[model samples]
Target: MAPVPLTVPRRALDIVVALALLVLLSPLLLFLTVLVRTTSGRPTVFRQQRMGEGAREFTLYKFRTMRPDATGPGLTSGSDPRVTGTGRLLRRFALDELPQLFNVLRGDMTLVGPRPEPAELARRFPPEYQWMFRHRPGLTGPCQLHSRSHAALLNGMPDPEEYYLSVMVPRRAAMNAELLAHITLTTVVRYLARTLWYLLSAAWDRSGGSSGRPGGDATRRTEEGRSLCVRS
Candidate 1:
């Protein structure tokens, strides 16, 4: 599939909104920084090498949401032990990702686009999956919300790079391409609203309410098995 060209107007809008969001959220960012420091013990921000448009490498930013030593390949199950108490709160509310606003301002990312994958994962995927490189990576995208479980499966797999390329990446790339084709200010606004709602809902559920467990453990386990297949 060919890369979709970004319209000039859309690009301009992206710049304007990204800059405005950074400025408007500065106080929130500061507050989060202090909270993370007190809770996670310094290094409030985490950076990782991620693939961007044209398969370029860039350092993606996020508020640290895992233990300082919790580095390695594994799926982040709801019950992952590595998630600190405050980290769980941050993840549930999506507050941990607030640092990526800087990525948008840096032009390495867009507010609405395909979420970038770690460069190692990108390298493992095939060329077709590489189509994701056609557009800037995003802080949030279609796949981010709808495919959380699938993403967890992919990320947890032994050869996730291959599974992502063979399965998830192609499908998500298509969705992202479609989104790019229909990009507009109204659509972007709607996407943001939906994403915010989803985050809030998840947070609400986590706060002593119903667990929005989308699938049964059996189903999740099946997906996990498939993830293992990519390696075998």
Candidate 2:
């Protein structure tokens, strides 16, 4: 199923929330933009094609974390060599994604929906998982909330891309489908609150490198997060 309709109310909420966020976070956004520009050189904001609703393609924006001239596999774990010091911190705390609020304002995305899959990754999804494209992609969702943990897992993988496509992709599709199938206002609210907490809490992690990989408190928190959104 495509989930209950949130067309009118959801779009309204997305606009109100997105605009508020953009305004409130403007200073930090400017700082990060300048930070990336100075360190990585021009084009501080990274733009790439991501799959949207109905498999349509649209440009997704984020602060550039990798070297501007980087030439490596597209799928990267946080620990990848191409990631800059600023890039690593931005990725760790998800400050790089603050620009995606613009994506929500533009109607290319929603505040809560499936994580926008890359075109290549979406193309490789199994037939059963194709239903995920029925809705616009999200700034945050079930899969997105635990992205840190997922990145941590990918860090330990010898072949991250292949493992992600083979294991993580299908798992995410199923989890996202389940949540969307029963989505509601409260579900959306919980997700947004949880996402904020997840992002803010990342600051407490003192890991010099790596995404605070799964272990001890990290594992517990990941499990707690997973349990939060998997329910109706």
Candidate 3:
């Protein structure tokens, strides 16, 4: 398949929205930085290398939620012991990922797209899955949307690494490919709106309120899985 051209309009939207959010959320970002520093110690921001557009590698940033010498394999299972107290909270709300706005600003990522995979992990994807990387990785997208509760799901699994690689990775990659193939302005807007609803609903659940449904807690449980992977 031919590579899709980089979406200039998408990049422009990413830049505008990221810049506006960075400016608007500056105070919260600063407070979170200080909190992470005091709670986790030095290196307020955690940087990890992720595979980016066209299979390039770039440094992805998040608030330091784990200790400097955190142990365990690459996959973070639910409630892994390495997470700091503040890190757990940050991961719960995805505050840790706010730093990636800079990555979006730098053109390494976008507000919505496939979440970037780690370089080594991404390399293991099936050959057909590679095409999903033609555009910048996103902070929110179909993979992220579907995996909202993955951390909780994988928590205490026999081997999170195995399951994530063998099961989750392929499924998410296929979903990403589908999203990429059908990408459009309307689709992007719909995805963005859905993400907002998830965040809001998750926050509402965390506040000890119900949305008047039988599976309300289940939804919250999934949102709690935000930290189950990289940030958890």
Specify the highest-TM-score model's number: 2
Residue 40, model 2: lDDT of: 64
lDDT of 2 by residue, 95-154 (tens): 878888999999889998988876766687778777788788888898887776676776
Residue-level lDDT of model 3, residues 1-232, one tens digit each, is: 3434557888788888889999999999999978876776676776666778878888787776666666555656545666677876776566777888999999888777888876656776678677766667888888776544666556667866677777777777777788878887677778878977766666655532211111011111222232223432
C-alpha displacement of 229 in model 3, angstroms?
23
Per-model tally of clashing residue pairs: 0, 0, 4
Question: What does candidate 1's lDDT look like per residue over 160-192, in tens digits?
Answer: 445655776677778888987787878878888
Q: For model 1, what is the C-alpha lDDT against the true structure?
A: 0.63
**TM-scores of all predicted structures:** 0.77, 0.84, 0.82
Angstrom error of the Cα, residue 79, model 3: value is 1.8
Residue-pair clash count for candidate 3: 4
Highest lDDT against the true fold, candidate:
2
Error of 3 at 56 (Å): 0.6
